[model samples]
Target: MLTSTFGAPLAQKSARAKEITKCIAVFMAKDMRPFSVVENEGFRLLINTLEPKYHIPSRQYFSQTEIPALYKQTKEKVIQTLRQANSIAITTDGWTSRATESFITITAHVITDEWEMLSFVLQTRPLYEAHTGVHIAEILRSAVAEWELERAACGIGVVTDNARNMDVAVREAGLAPHVKCFAHTLNLASQAGLSVPRVHRLLGRVRRVVAFFHRSTTAAAVLTSNQKAMELPQHKLIFDVVTRWNSSLDMLERYLKHQSAVAATLLSPYVRRNAREIDTLDHADINDAEDIVKLLKPMKMATTVLSDEKTPTVSLIVPLKHMIESSMAPNEEDSATVSAMKRAILDNLSNRYTDVYDWLLECTALDPRFRTLPHLEEDLRQDVFRRLREKAVQLSNKTNVTMEEADEGDGGEGTSGPTPAAEQPVNLTGTAEEAEVEQPPPNKKTALEDLLGGTFTEPAVAESQVYCIESEMAKYKNGKPISLKSCPLEWWKENAKIMYPLLSPLAKAYLSIPATSVPSERVFSTAGDIVNVQRSQLLADNVDMLIFLKKNM
Candidate 1:
């Protein structure tokens, strides 16, 4: 093949396309005032060699025209992707920016025919009305309609924080089955655990100590030097954010890790001048900090496991809830404040999540890995199993025996291919010409089921009911729970269709429920970066466009 030149002649782009391109580039760069940047002598000089003939658009063009056009295009694509889903779950949360503007993020979760998981950030619209249950529900309904999911065959559910307003909103929107974010619940428990007065005082002192080191380069330098001399790792001091639940754990862990270095640094003349008596960590302070960190590690893991979107988290909800609650009882070796914290956590989990276990039991009961119905209270166990079987049969919507299709000219089974012997044939096929134009045979069950095994040759009701009974009965076999590391979705995707056909739909439905609304909360973290001091003047509409493109594109 002949070699082509490094660059080739190209047609000039339309002003609108060029404008959209520049605004997206600038928006993604987290920059404000595109015109100023484009007009800069250095910026112009750098881009000159790459595109000598092109000119950058004015800020007015980007703000007024390009952002709106780009948003419209991206939104259409998001809707198209959403329209293909058999079911949809949503995760939403609200945030306030440094600009003091309130915004809500909504993301849709869907599972494809091949058992692949996908998500789309549907909207990051500003919240103009009061952020109440009714208002949030209204916005959610609009988002649902925009994606045409209001009339969607498979239903929609929302995962959100356990905040009262959010709890009220999903119910008001008629999207409830009590699917609060497990990760957020864990955080709240952690929060309550730390609320004991002494522990609270300890955390306050820790933050102050960290704050002193955080803003002081001299203090950090002295600490690092001491760490080097002591042959310890020179880790940075961790600071806590008010909104981040685990920040205190992180601060304490880091402080304890460099405990000796910090002690040495505080004695240095520069630190002595700045640090107060309260900033110093005594032996008791160190012990309390260690206890807090030890208690929080498992919770952090629980948060991480639930917040994950790549794997199934819904199945882990009940099991992890049990794990978290069992860990809440304090050992006798624990200090008085630490004991109080554990009891508080225990109380919080019991009160806040009394109904959650029942909701999650339905999910766990359907999972093949953790078929531990015994995990549920004895009174509720059988009911959960009954609900599982009922749910599967209902969702399958395959209650009646299927009418057999005519195979031969006499509507006969004489030309038997693979039809099961149990269901005798009944001719449903019409005239040859009409049959030719018909949609694919309704003999096939589910798309996922077909992937595991072919169309059902047996009568539908007998087969579905058998699978339903088998699924409920499977729970009593060997009461051990699966490893936390196991992926229940993969187990079902690989085997459930063949083993428990009726329960497959239930498996897919509950497995697809999102464990956390962190996807929406994560959008706000990105929003914080996008709307910083440098780009403080970014308009609300354009900010929405930039965020949409950043995520969707």
Candidate 2:
């Protein structure tokens, strides 16, 4: 056997070698590096220098053994954590990589018993089948079973984009309480507005101007010089993508920011002779851009808020929708193009989101920050609270059933048949002495009082469960809303046990839902890095393990 100068065999499984191999695997997964990185001369030298006795494994060793083992171990830990979750909400989306291979990514969001929000990337499996609704539905069902989420004690909802196929797939999978991505809906509406001929033409001219600067090095240099001369922030122009509406807004904002520099650069004597293709925006166009920005600024803010993964955002959808609708309302001072654009957006959004509105409204009402629902009218507000109270009663009943089942599981309560109730006051509001108020004789009742069931002090019946629910609702209603900076989970953690036990669980169910498919979308963003040119031929199974470990570990 070959031996090093120190006389130990080079490839023996020492502790240091095992630890270094584990570190190398983690580096590949977490940093999105190709397995072959270990084989690179520079990387090999660095490892050897760090630990002369340690042997660097081949790429085959890491890819075949180390990565798979890491993924399996990390997956077990994630599954354990997920099993502890009472309610889970999922976000899933499909992506096509640079290799032209299709894949689906699923991410799970849960609110722990302690009211802390956690998210985990479940998988990113390559799709060999057609991207049909039935196929997608099957994939989703398999994913739920694989993750052990099908047996969730409470609800399992899914958030997805507004793709018709996704809607069909989620419905087919029977993941009730499906919510369309609010950001996607906003983008659809914005795209519709941008399709108006006048807006399209204006944007075409802006796109051309931005393209000119991007393509012409001389023109870009001139613009930078002009920016410095004008004492402006040296910001580069943003190019918009056709698929993303926010990117258009970003481009327009950057264009407007560097308007002075751009105008000077385009009008420079040398540029007039050299690059005559650049278009100049007139004053009216500038005003139109400003109006469009003003109209879309609220939506941009709403999108940012709903795309939040760290905080609860499903509750923000309805409130943010109301705000955007108000902003889109026609103003007398609006330009024709702006007015047309607003109408187009409103028309597109008019009949949308009807399917998920009820539950999202419930989420809004349950969220303490927006419980009052100032955006809604008085009657609508009442309706929301009514539905909330009804649900609370249902939840209470379900909890009772669950507790009973558990008791039965514990050996039939040792043949007690059923436990006896404590002889406490029906309202549970008075002391023991106060609850034992002296009752008058039956004959002391007046005729009217006897007909009406009883007098106020001596009620005829016990307090109904409905009344108890109403009291809890009232107490929750009277609470002052927490600040916008406070996390709803943190607030619930503080109060769920003692203050509003019944509603707090319901709050977790509603608030755990994500408002967008951005979690899965983010996974694709990382996937792009993993499946780049260097690793394009990576196998689908390896890709799955790598992505899972990358996100989870």
Candidate 3:
């Protein structure tokens, strides 16, 4: 052996070289470990460092065959995980990617008496075709069956947004008894109400003005200058659903406050002629500027009230009740101002109040079987009838149209003259029979006859008996006897068909469940977070896996 710098060399150089190679190979073998046990955190860091320096040959690290295997394994695991749930509700929606490929995301909520979001699964199929009801149902059914849940009693409910296709899918899947998403219903109602002609006109004007200010730098500067001059708060022209309504009201309020500034802006040479046209626009009822101000004041007040932390306490029934009571017995010293206010409120109540009442009545009529469900049916029916009755009574009383029973026959006197009945003290505690006999017939039918025929008959005097002896009494002053008719009762009995269907659980659920798109919004938000630009290249299975893990684990 000979010394070669820091080490010794053998006499046989070839043998020595082979020995050195063997030692190096042993060291490298000792350093190697199974990839399965490796921690992902360090692996990710290593991959990141190598990604920019030297490409490890694209498509080599992730085996093409492994993807399908992993998906199969994951699918099995997910199905097993969800199998333990007693009840599962599914929410689904479809979205198209930038590549124009449609994808349907299905989120399953496992509810065990207490509702909770359990698992979210993105189906493997690419929904490339048109998103119709039949297609959605087919995809959903396939996914459910793939999980071996076709016959599973685990699925009890489904909550979704008000997409016609999605709703159709849910119904076809036989999940009708589920709670229809109330939040979605509310959104629908809000959208529908916002789309009304009056609302549309107001919104359109505001939108145009806002767009004008935003589109041009000069107009924006002018608006900013006006804002500073008027001491108005700095707010952008962006339209938010609730905020825009309030914002329009605010603009009107501000315009009313500083009419001169608005007038100056409208008349400015830089402002477009079309923009200035709003100043000359005449509303039919509100003729003058003062009238416009008056009209807007109440709306502004209402908007402010609604914006408060506490929800406003105005009910569709309360104002009508008060008006009816007032009309029945008007104050002796009613002033013109009071009379005008009353009339205005009444007119508003008359025009707007009925829709809400009609909606409520429709809500009550949702369930014909609701009447069979203990006190629920009666309570709902009575409440709806009560409000409607009150409204009708108010209208009738204000118009001074008496709704009462007609007298049967005249006294046996030979005179064919009209005999009037004097106002008698009403017996508040009188028996039903006694009241029925004393009161005049509200219509042509007899009370006893109608009641036996399954109708509520008003109190009426007997037709056969002669009242000559009673007529001779000085207390019996002549006046036409007005019959008392409960309009609500009549309406209820007459519209039973329309009302019963509305009272059904299905109908009540449909009505009570707000027509909103909140679920779809939530789904979109969740998708945005999960499928970001950075993760755009992720495999569909991995995307589903990531969402499932993040949502569940």
RMSD of each: 9.9, 9.1, 24.0
Best by TM-score: 2
Q: Rank the candidates by lDDT, best first.
A: 2, 1, 3
Candidate of highest lDDT: 2
Residue-level lDDT for 317 in candidate 2: 86
Model 2 weakest lDDT span, ten residues long: 421-430
- Point out where model 3 deviates above 4 Å: 1-81, 112-125, 147-155, 176-179, 240-520, 526-553
The CA lDDT of each predicted structure is 0.69, 0.80, 0.39
> Candidate 1 — which residues are off by over 4 angstroms?
1-43, 63-69, 151-154, 273-279, 377-380, 398-483
User: Candidate 1's residue-wise lDDT over 207-313, tens digit each?
Assistant: 88888888889998998899999999878989987667788788888888887888889889988887765367778888888888888889888887777887767
Higher-TM-score candidate of 1 and 2 = 2
User: Per-prediction TM-score, please?
Assistant: 0.79, 0.88, 0.43
1-553 in candidate 2: lDDT tens per residue?
3254545735647787788899999999999999999879999889877777778888999998899989989999998898776568899999988999999999999989888889999988778988888899998988887987742124478988888888789878877578888899999999998898988888899999888888888888898999999999878899999999989999999999999899899889867666576678999999989888888888888888877787899998888888777788989998998999989999988777786687788898788887787877888887777777766655554445444544654664422121221111111111223333233223345677777655553342234666766887888876788888888778888888888777776788788889999989988788999999999999999888988888889
Q: Which parts of model 2 have CA positions greater than 4 angstroms off?
A: 1-4, 10-12, 151-153, 403-468
